[model samples]
Target: MSVSPEAIRSALLARREIALIDVRQEALFALGHPLFAAQIPLQRIALEAPWRIPRQNTPIVVYDDGEGLAEPALHQLRALGYTQADVLEGGLAGWKAAGYELFEDVNSYSKAFGELVEHRRHTPSLPAPDVLALIEEKADIAILDARRFDEYATMSIPGGRSVPGAELVLRAPVAAPDPDTTIIVNCAGRTRSIIGTQSLINAGLPNRIFALRNGTIGWTLAGQALETGRQESVEKGEGSGHDLARERARDVAYRAGVRRIDSADLKGLIADSDRTLYRFDVRQPADFAAGHPAGFRNAPGGQLVQETDHFAPVRGARIVLVDDLGSRADMTASWLAQLGWEVLVLADAFDGPLETGDDGAPPPRGPHGRYKRPYEGTDNREAAMQAYLDWEYGLVAQLERDGTHGFFVI
Candidate 1:
């Protein structure tokens, strides 16, 4: 069966559940695609589809930009028992011909939502020079690197400590205990910094907080130096501040419309086989590997927020997060809800020795056709980095014109 672009657009407009799959390599797919079109790449359909689109009868429309991969994808999906699979009539060309917007780059919607957060909430930030001056002056400041630990170790601001996005709420209190200390959050680029900085503000932190404006890209363009092989991490305290952190994060999540549910509620969600559901343990990998509730996959909350489209390509699926500390899940769920997913923090205080082993990392789809992001490497053209920042600044307007992303900043 073939579905029209108009029909796909209508489904999104009405908030109906649909999976818009783009069966092309990540490199080709990243050139441009519909805001909600997930790149499954033809070879990954069998590997990623069953987990990504869990509902066997979920309405799915696969497309390609004249690569002729969509029809084969439809066949593969049907063979795997996806009853409601169909091909997008006219493929990517058809969607464009229908006068719809195509977003560039991966994680487009989440990044756009980050831009919207800055636009609406006026999230505060400091330029690279000011931050550099603070470090040189030895000012009372705490620079928190909000990327993954390995990313922090690779290259980061001087004196910056690794505190990935979701950990900010739980660990910031310990990182900067004094109310007088200034706090700055930085990521390789903008989204996580904006979200991390704003997350603290939303959680009612007394310490002054700012995002490292434009993140490391901005720092590099400003002719500033970065510290490499810095293994410093934010101290996870001995339960002194967790209750307060939990209280604050819960307030933030409540403001962002994230729900807290018990084991009984989880059972209800699991029984609803008609709808797609994802269960995750949003904690540090080590903590998860130590012990975690059975049946929940490890998805470090920080990265999950950054890569939601890849992790949960079924856009409308419900997500349930469990963390030993409820605050982590609440903070994570808050961002997910704002990004337009139905999300809840699973709050069951389970008692027992839980599952432990290697967190089943998702099968790696090889990097054969991965899109090379401009901000990744140490040596990027200044113009490309600046252009990327410029593109992000205009995303709020683009989001308005597209009108499909139901994102709101809290």
Candidate 2:
């Protein structure tokens, strides 16, 4: 069976459940593909198909650049019980022939959506030099690293503490109790920093909040030193701080039209075999391994939002986030809601007995097909870093032309 590019485009615009997969290596997929395409290389089809595309009846459309992989991929998907698998009519060439846009990078649309949020909301930011000056002066400032703790520990700004994106709203108050202290959020690159800073702003944090413009890339470009093996993190405990964060995040999530569901409602959603449901525990990996609600996989809220397509490949699928702390799930759901997802926060479901150990599945592909991200690792070339920032800068314009993204910044 063959599917037309126009048909896929229409389905995307209408927010229908469709999985447009690019059966190519990550490097090639990163070079160019459709705005909503998810890369599940042909070799890893068997490994990824079951979980990534959970619904056997999901409308699956595979494409390749005349690489002879699409048809085989469709067969593999079918063998895996994907009953509705089909190929793009003309592959990548066909998509181009139809005069549609081909986006670059794996998580292209999600990055573009982040740029859209910044463009729409004018998210506040501070350049690296200015932030460095404050640190040198020993000013009242709290630098929260919004990337994962492992990433933060690798290299970070001096005196910066790990508070990952999902933890920002929940723990920022505890990290910087003084409202007079300026809070600066930084990630490895732009997207998480923008989203993290905006999250705090949306939650109505009293402190002056700003994204470290261009994140660690800007800090390096400015000739600033980065700390290695730093162990600082937000103090963990429940108190008035947690209560305030919960209230604030709940307000933001409600404003973004995120639904709050009890266990019964979650069960009903799960029972609806017609729809695809993803249950996630939006907490840190260690915390998730320590204890999380049964049947929910661990997905740190920040990474989940930053890589929504990678995490939830099936577009239009419903997502239910579980978090005992309330703030992480609520804040994460708010962004997903704006990104046009039917997202909900699973409330009070974690009060019962919890399971331990990591239940999440790793990405199917190994090192062979993986594209080396310019923003990660310690040895990125200056040119590559600059090129990455350049790509991000153009996302807003690209998103405008794409026109299918139903993202709304709050």
Q: What is each predicted model's overall lDDT from 0 to 1? A: 0.88, 0.91
Q: What is the Å distance of residue 352 in model 2 from its true position? A: 2.7
What are the per-residue Cα lDDT tens digits for candidate 1 across 185-241? 999889999999999999999999999999999999999988889999987775758
Please give the lDDT score at residue 256 for candidate 2.
95
- Cα lDDT tens digits, model 2, 1-410, are 79999999899998999999999999999999889999898988998888788889999999999989998999999999989999999999999999888888778877898899899999999999999999989999999999999999999989999998999998898888899999999998899999999999999999999999999998887788788899999875578878988999999999999999998898899899888898899999889999988989888999999989888999989999988889999999999999999999989877789999988585546678799888777788889899899999998888788788888887
lDDT of 1: 0.88
- What is candidate 2's TM-score against the reference? 0.98
Q: Number of the top candidate by lDDT?
A: 2
**What does candidate 2 score in Cα RMSD to the true structure?**
1.2
Q: Indicate the TM-score of model 1.
A: 0.97
